[model samples]
Target chain A: MERVLFKPLSQVAICGGTHGNELCGVYMLKELPRDRSGTFSLTTVLANPRAVDTCQRFTEKDLNRCFTDTLLSDLLTEDSPYEVRRAQELNALLGPKGSEATMDLVCDLHSTTSNMAICIITHLNDRVGQHLFKYMREKIRSAPVRLILLTSPLSEGYSLDCLGKHSCTIEVGPQPHGVLRADVYNQMREAVDRMLEWIESFNSGTVFEGGEVEGYSMVEKKDYPRDPETQELTAVIHPQLQDNDFCLLKPGDPVFMTFSGETIHYEGDELYPFFVNEGAYYEKNTAFVLGQKQSLLVPSISVEKEQ
Target chain B: MERVLFKPLSQVAICGGTHGNELCGVYMLKELPRDRSGTFSLTTVLANPRAVDTCQRFTEKDLNRCFTDTLLSDLLTEDSPYEVRRAQELNALLGPKGSEATMDLVCDLHSTTSNMAICIITHLNDRVGQHLFKYMREKIRSAPVRLILLTSPLSEGYSLDCLGKHSCTIEVGPQPHGVLRADVYNQMREAVDRMLEWIESFNSGTVFEGGEVEGYSMVEKKDYPRDPETQELTAVIHPQLQDNDFCLLKPGDPVFMTFSGETIHYEGDELYPFFVNEGAYYEKNTAFVLGQKQSLLVPSISVEKEQ
Candidate 1:
């Protein structure tokens, strides 16, 4: 039997295969060569090992969504052998109540169902998340990325969200079952390198001024269809927005109009489209800039001799 | 001469020998042991090294206060060949835009004029700060410690404050010139170890639950008193208060009336103290337990034909 032991080292967590089908993140982890570099004092772990083996979303529950304090504690205490054991193992490595080698960052890797490029999901208003996201965006500026979504608030019981305030989820685009794309792998590797570099810079007393993106925006409302039989909510997306398309609308502009046999009436600006294709929702990239209104600008004036 | 190359590594940072009389932190760093089990990824830098040799606060300006982005950036881009070159070296190790290996943590060690236990100054509502503070409290529970104060609302332009979020300022009590305290060194070493443990925990997917200590109150309210002749603000501390003392007043309580020579009168259900001790301003421990109100309990008759 393999001996279960705890080594006194800095830990690095990488979570992949949360969707059961996506493989890019997993492949990247498996392929990345571990070298002894003075970059990061790293201790890495692969969460949801069983899910990765079975190629299933989850066995009985979504492992990513089962990271609540109560659930994790209960799992740790229970006699049953489950994935919670992995979490307990991680905790042991973190040490007793007073041990100093605690977590600094948690990067959970994943892949979306849609064919979008790499994106990072994290909390809004988080300093580390914002800085890292800006750094990552600049690292991969020329990619077929749809949007870097901030989905922590929407999904409360997420693994990375529960780890630390600085934790983030990296989502690579759709990958064929059991196959990882080279582009996605390269991006993930680059991100990991960037993270290590950031840590090194911090320890060295050097300032790392991450790149400045445009800004951030929030997703106020999303349109969905209703089921005909049960009248329950169902998946639906209309007026699919293209990348970087800025939506311009004045106050009180009609946003949603009900269709009645060709009659298209106006509806109030309850859900105005400010910037279409604002990208995925994440904490740091939550806000995005909109086109400046011409009316709001003050007209330039010529100065007199007094000026 | 050495190559003077900028090597980006995770190493410790030591600063503040302004007064030739105060050098506890500097000595501690110089005497730190190199042999350890876990990885010590750090970049070591001696801020104001010249001051250390000269036994002075500064030659031109207070280096601690010169942490603005513009000033630092200028130092990085200037034409001078002295400290500017050092700044350039530090930046190269920190990495340029999109460079991997950024800084992970920074600790600006210093010694105060007054005698007190070690204290960590960091921003409130910051997860990293909370985690580090909690870990330290747990480790030093058996020590001869008075209390751990968390200084918040940090004024701008301090090195650690300007650090990439996960940074802290460790202040040690007054020590004789060029003297090293074993206790202080051990405490700092333990703190650094705990920091690494935190990073490991985070990397291994262990969630860091902050202590119930919600926040801290400022000890001093009035601005630093200026010297009569120099008219420059001088550091001053109020009288220390005992733990669980009666000097603190609840929120909205009159500050003048409580501090005046007159006796305090209370008309409400209960009056809670606010600022109590010399350095005590507010409650740093915010966690509390839920208790049942006395009015909620009732005696019930038995259901056996209850006559």
Candidate 2:
């Protein structure tokens, strides 16, 4: 277990209400106390406040998808989307992303209608993210946890998590918008706490060992079958696939069932699926994303000694 | 069996999309072919077209609840609610409330997030409604079926179903708003077909048996536990009660669980609960409605022979 020496994580942020309708995160923010410890600084943000007020995911544009470097630095006019301006403000606050002055880590919270139990998503090839996901999977005991690595570069990353130097998103689900479950709320609370604890342990001189970690790397997305003429959906998620996220999907397996009582089978290559049958993704026509199994050997690291 | 007779049902209307996000009916309307037969004329309505287009429950006000006589006859200024005008227009087409020219029967379609399987909601004291529900229960074997009797006067009815001479609402659920499932859509389709079949049978002089029918009569509503200071929800539906609609809720049974993981038990009299934990009802602060089991002996009836 060779350790790679690095600077201690001194600046951390926890954000929620990125999607106003997702209540687990929105309410979790209210319960989190502001913290300013001697070792590190903590910032908690309520993202997309107007959307939360109306219980709408977003007013004009989705705030979660507004954090790309291009969008963050873009000039804002009076007619600019509300989320774009909000993203810029966020950049000024915790990000100005890709800069050395940026926050050490940002943990964005989300909830999905899809039965993705507990998903920790991070940027691929980031050694810090890999170590963090491994820690989360080990510490989170109440629910099944899985990590997804996005291959997109940080500058091209669209989610709010990509705004920090080191970042990840915690998505808990089988929960609906504007609705909360005690189990889900508990899951969210524990995740945030565990994340904070990990940061504290790292800053206190605990070394993270290098190891091969297992996760999913997305290959492509699958959209719902729709009527070509009307563009209306012709089928829905198959009974076999619904609520069975992260299951390996094989060719010729039932993926959808048409309104006419016909089963639509999967013809694509075998892959593990996540984000299955999300209600929010209905607007985007995405049924789910297919992923290939991945194993990454993360680098071991430690906080750099002060001075 | 001797039977009281009425005129044959010649004109019937089936309406969908009264609340547009409920997609079971919206798509069902598209699937129905126009019928202009010798025995009966079938008219299928896509109610609230604008709402359906936007995939919202309603643009301003709920269209399903906008069909009361007061709203239908109210003076329509340019500033009136869109649903009000639409209700008036529907009244002119299929109704002029309490008039002999009203449609013979109206089957308004609905879907809910609550696990109320196949709910046939009708006006209390209507023999036609009782007979229809009895018939639907026997015919629809793919799902569980239940009937709810509204105690309100027809004139005071707040739903689109009240616009006809004999009307009932076919509510199927646990379906999310804006998301359609093959199972739910199939249930909706079957319910509509059976209702129309019953209508034709009654019109052709089939005798509906006099018998005791069991159903639910709503007694009161229960709102979610909320923070007294902020009015934000403090607890969510307990896991035991979630998706357990139409179940006996006894005193001391867990109904809610606070975010802090404390169980909130039911303190009221024993009753059956339905429409439990509906997301749409979140806006109204209604967690669920309690009902008392009811038994009504409906009289045998037959369509009066012409002349």
Candidate 3:
């Protein structure tokens, strides 16, 4: 197999607190106590200080959805949302978006209320990302780490990680908003440690042989059933389905339970559910997302020497 | 046993959304759909509309703490907090605290992030409350229902339930903020049903017998380890202690895990911990409250007729 070569990573950025109330990432970046003098120059940032100060998800709009190119170049005025202005400032610090000056890698830390374990969410079919993800899955044993490939292209990505030349998002959870769990935080730290280890080995001319790795590609999202008048959810994720992320959801499986004590079942083809009962998504109207499993034939990769 | 007598509950209020984000209570009150035409007149309330509208805990101050007489009587001015203003309105409708016009019973519904199943929180040693709690415990079978005797007297209580002549707080849990779980909501609904059933039986000249019931009484609260300079939490509830509410904590038992992976142990005498890893209490500077277990020797009670 031909090795996919790339120049050694020169600059890498890590950010947290994109949604502020996701405390695992917020604290990880704020209290990182290590001498990070490594082969790669590292930059750490708190993505949303205003929201983190009050432990709110965001002030005006979700900063995560503000990173798209269209929003990045939008005219800035006093009436602009707080996240829009902050996103521009962040773009200046770590990114210019699709430019040579962008950081070599950007790894954003996120947390969710769902019971999905550590998830590596990245753009699909990127050899560099797949190899790194394979390394992380093999190395981290503290939690069951899984992969999720975004269906959209990198150019259309809206997350903060999309700012880098090569990017990956490390989302760890089951921790509630505004509450930090020691195990969740430690799992994220361990994953980051493993990522850094892989980066150093790649930069030092070590060849990583990759064959096959399994990942989930997002198919569609399902919102909770709601009352037409109130727009409030009329049903809740069923107890049988709650916290059962990454499990195959089949047709006729119980999915929701209405307030009147009636069970609602899934009517679609077999697909795996993720992000079941995420608290933040309650307002977003999303109950869970269904994903289709796929096998990625990752290729061997090594660092390319500077010409 | 001598039958303790009281005038049958006349005006009853069941309130929810006091702490806005506790959805178990919020939805139960909003979606209560049954023939509630009974012996006792019932008034349902959605407390703190401003906060509930945005799915936040509160807008200006915790409404639960604003019911204190001092705050309720504080001169309503332009500078008063939103909750203080709301508290005054609530007092006028349901209470003139320490007066004859207050509702007969104000049973407020609440939910917690801790796994403290269905908890009946009430003022300690009130015969009427004890008998009703005993009745509910015997009737409800879906969830483990327990009792919590508030250490503070009703005169000094700050909760919304204090507005009633006789009040009880039904707190159910393990549900995250802004997220509703069907099981938790159903547990609360069952409790309210049992309470109404008790009320009807008591008003119909039925005698209730109670011997002893197990309950927990309040003790000191412990805060998470913090960095003195930054005031940011330095540790989180240990994996061993997370979700283990109502479990005993003894000297040398692991209580917290530092961000740097060190375990901190409890140093106090054996006590049960409740509200373990509660998300809202994180900002209140409380990790969990230690409780002392007690056995209440309750007396028989019956309705006191117009005499």
Candidate 4:
């Protein structure tokens, strides 16, 4: 692994409360060092104000899911939901998309009820995102910055970060929606601060030495047990697996428990569960998303543009 | 305290999901033996189906709060939101109000994000409610069914339980809204089953021996610390007081912790806090409510009509 300088970015946007009930990002973004930049412009946004007011995931539709190209193109529809219009407006503000984006870097903030530590979700090939992840892994002390790559099959064009090529999301949690836990709050704040420092260093053409990073690649999501007839939940996450997010779930592990005291075991291959039992994902039938570990030597980003 | 026989009721409704995301009630109600009729008629209703579909507290206004006379009376207004109309419809179905009600008992079920135990909230003078509370106290094994009396000044007429004088609430918690923990779910189901058995005994002219019950009375609610400039939350529940729900708080006990790490101490007389740091209460500025403990000897209800 070689240390190489990365090119300085001209402008970046830091966003929070995209899900509304997630308060850490909103709280942290408000206190960020907006004045610390002589090298680049920093724009902070509270993405969904109406949802935040009601302490909900979204107002009409999920703001995160409303950023699809089709939805953004149909922004003029009079019957469009609140989040559709918001996506179009945000796209215009930070992005025109692809190369025309005003934001050279986009850092969207989110929190989960999962015990994921300083999670950084981005495209697998995103160089800038990888650089940021490496910086946080080396810099942040409280917890490891776990990088999870969203593979090609997972639709990326429907999220705020998709508006820009050099974008990443900061996801930290185990904090319930609309509730602020001091431990998680501080962890999230530190994540944002470290991320900002990483951006600042990149903008200043500081070299980020390449290092080995341990992370997971998202596979697929699994739904909890539901009644075959009514489709309502028939079982709950087992007591053993309840708060064991990000832990390796091997075959035969107890996964769910029926009301009558029947325990259901995991019959699948070993996988790590993240975002276990997130309240926001209840409607989606998501008990948790499985991830597979990958050990990689992150390459340094060179400041020079290849001719 | 000597147990006396309570009058048999003709009909009862066990309701759940009033807040939609509270799953224990909805899940428990689904499996209840609705056909059993050796005693009173048992009707199970999932209160806010739309909110449950979306895994939120409500669509427009809180369904629980929408039961007020003004909203129920104004159900014909096109301006009335989903929950308002739902409230009016619910009142019409389970209630007509007071002594004219067809349903002898309306047990509204709820779950909180707070660490509240199996809580029974109702007017202290409601003798039947007190008897049920005493029954739960003696029967349920996990936690004591703590009673909280909503005095007249508290505006009880605004809630679903206010539909009839015989109505009472079964609130259990430490569970987040959308996520169902198996531990909490089982506890809630037990509470509901025990309640039904208590009702059946009353209906069968079975004498309930009077017994002493331990519970609390609501004193007042306290809001969390907010920034003077933005009115946004500036503090969180102190680590020491976070999960200490139903536990006594002395004058010098820390209740809140500022973002800057400052601890705010309780300054009032010794009172227990319930529903501490409930995520749903954030919008209402409710950090938690204060409760003073009370020990009461519940009297047996005689089935005989004295006239």
Using DockQ, give the best candidate's number: 3
lDDT of each: 0.42, 0.85, 0.88, 0.80
lDDT of 1 by residue, A147-208 (tens): 33353442254463346435667765433233333344555666666666655554444444
Off by over 4 Å in 3: B33-35
lDDT tens readout by residue for model 4, A1-307: 6655444676888889899989888787777776773667888988998888877789889999877767878837778888989988898898866655457778888988776768898777677788788887778888767888876522346788777657789998878788887878878778777777777666666666676777788788999888789787878889888878778999999998987779999988899988888877867879988999987777777565434
Candidate 4 scores a chain A TM-score of: 0.93
* Residue-wise C-alpha lDDT for candidate 2, range A1-307, written one tens digit per residue: 6777767778878889899888898888877767555578888899889999988889899998888877887888999999999999988898788888888888898998788878888888666777788888888889988889989887688888877888888899878676776677788888778887888898898887778888899999899998899889888888788888999999999999887678989998999988887778888878999999988888788888999
lDDT of 4 by residue, B151-174 (tens): 662234677877654777999878
Indicate the DockQ of the complex predicted as candidate 2: 0.53
Q: Output DockQ, candidate 1.
A: 0.00
TM-score against truth, every candidate: 0.36, 0.95, 0.98, 0.89
**Which of 2 and 4 is ahead in TM-score?**
2
Minimal lDDT window, size 10, model 1 chain A: A295-304
Best-to-worst order by DockQ is 3, 4, 2, 1
> Which 10-residue window of candidate 4 chain A scores lowest in summed lDDT?
A149-158
lDDT of 3 by residue, A136-217 (tens): 8888878899999987877788989989888889988887888888788888999888888888888989999979889999
Note the chain A TM-score of all models in turn.
0.62, 0.97, 0.98, 0.93
Alpha carbon lDDT of residue A282, candidate 1? Answer: 13
B245-275 per-residue lDDT for model 1 (tens digits):
2233343432221111222232232232222
What TM-score does prediction 2 earn? Answer: 0.95
Q: How far out, in Å, is residue B249 in model 3?
A: 0.8
Candidate 1: which docking quality band?
incorrect
Candidate 1 regions off by >4 Å? A1-11, A75-101, A144-157, A174-179, A210-223, A228-236, A242-307, B1-307
**Residue lDDT tens for model 2, B121-235:** 9989667887899998877889998999999877788888888888889999877777776677788889888887888888877888877789999999999999899898888
